[model samples]
Target: MTRILCIGEAMVELSAQGDLWRAGIAGDTLNTAWYLRRLLGPSHHVGYLTRVGRGDFSRRAVDFMAAEGIDTSHVTTDPTREIGLYAITLTEGERSFTYWRDTSAARGLADGPDRLQSALVGCDIAYLSGITLAILPDAGRAALLDALRGRDVVFDPNLRPRLWPDAGRMRAAITEAAGLAALVLPSFDDEAAHFGDADPKATIARYRAAGAGQVVVKNGGGPVAYGGPEGSGVVDDLPRDRPVDSTAAGDSFNAAYLAARLEGGTCADAIRAGHALSRRVIAHPGALVRAAV
Candidate 1:
């Protein structure tokens, strides 16, 4: 089985209801891991790598992963800190987050190089995001990059510029990370806004110049552009249909695309898989729609 390691944070998500909130597990990498495991079914082994506290919430998160068929063996226990928490509100089907994660235990995921190296033992693919890079301290980030040196890394510059100290630092880090990645998936909208790229072609060119071997640029309502040696495009034409929630759209797309491509499907098939899964996710609420999986 192909073993994939999703490295990042998973937080307790509270979605606003009429007077109360619904609690669940959600995060960029975690969402991808969940959808990846679901799509792959029994063929691939998916593991989440992060640190969590000994609190009940942390325990619940771990149990959630196990229930979702994800491996929790690399989840480290940090006695002093608990998992992060976030609240979400949907405004016209778009979601906004209020994070209470300053002391999130996952910030220490790369605390020890040796431990990270050990955990990578059986991993065939390593996946992470720009948010993962933002959460870590310099030392932790350095440790993570070191451990990822020779791995088949898949990265998404899920850009949230506000999280970084500055745009320059974020670019430097992202460029370095892209260089280490075998595949770099970036949203064209975010790329244009953050990097001043004029088009998806520019986004592809930028990442390739930064040393990424494969690049896929997703455009919300435009043609999805991808390039390695050749180029291809796919546009999402499915009806928006008054989305209940647009959360984790990119996350789900990433999962389906990766899962299909890993299973030897063609790029066109992978893109369609991504588009179909993303459409399904947006029609529901929250970052994850676990039921009917």
Candidate 2:
């Protein structure tokens, strides 16, 4: 079986519900892992790599991952630190977050990376995001990137500037990570806001120059620009439904796109799959919605 390793944290999500809250496990990479497992079914093995603590939230997080059919064999066990937590606040179909993740166990994943290295031994593809780099300690980040040297990487620079020490550091890290990736996914608004790219095409050119072989630029409610060694063009006929919550739009899109690509679909087909899933995801709440969503 082809094993795809998703490297990052899986936090305890607390989503608002008027006078109450809905609890779940969610994170950028975790959302992708969940959707990929669902889309790929039994043909591929989807593994999630993270470190969690010995608390109840951690235990529930593990059980939640298992329930989603994600491989947890390589997940690390850290006793000192507990799982991170984040709460969601929705407003007119968009979402905002309030995080309390100082002691997140996943920050220690690459502190002593023997197990992290061992887990990648037979992996076919590895996926991670900018958030993963921003959250790690310097040594851990360096170790993680060094270990990813020769794999086929799929990276998303889900830029959250506040997560990094500074813009320059985040830029340097994202540039290096993009160079390591076989395919790079960047959202247009985020790129424009961070890199001052004039448009989606500029975003593509930027990553291509950074050494990524293929680049995809996602424009919210607009055409998606794709450029790769095979060929490139715009996919504009994507779904345009009004989103109920835009929490995991990009993450879900990434999963569907990768699932289609892995199964030998064309870029256009992958984009369609991505857009379709993303549309469904936003019509619901939270990062990982129901299968019907």
lDDT of 1 by residue, 191-240 (tens): 99999999888998899998898898877735677887545564545444
TM-scores of all predicted structures: 0.96, 0.98
Q: List the residue pairs that clash in candidate 1.
A: none
- For each candidate, the alpha-carbon lDDT, in order, equals 0.89, 0.90
With a 3 Å backbone cut-off (N, CA, C), the pairs that clash in candidate 2 are none
Backbone clashes for every candidate come to: 0, 0
After superposition, which runs of candidate 2 have C-alpha atoms over 4 Å from their true positions? Answer: none
Q: Which lDDT tens digits does candidate 2 get at residues 247-283?
A: 9999999999999998999988888889889989998
Count of backbone collisions within predicted model 2: 0
lDDT for model 2:
0.90
The parts of candidate 1 lying over 4 Å away from their true place are 230-242
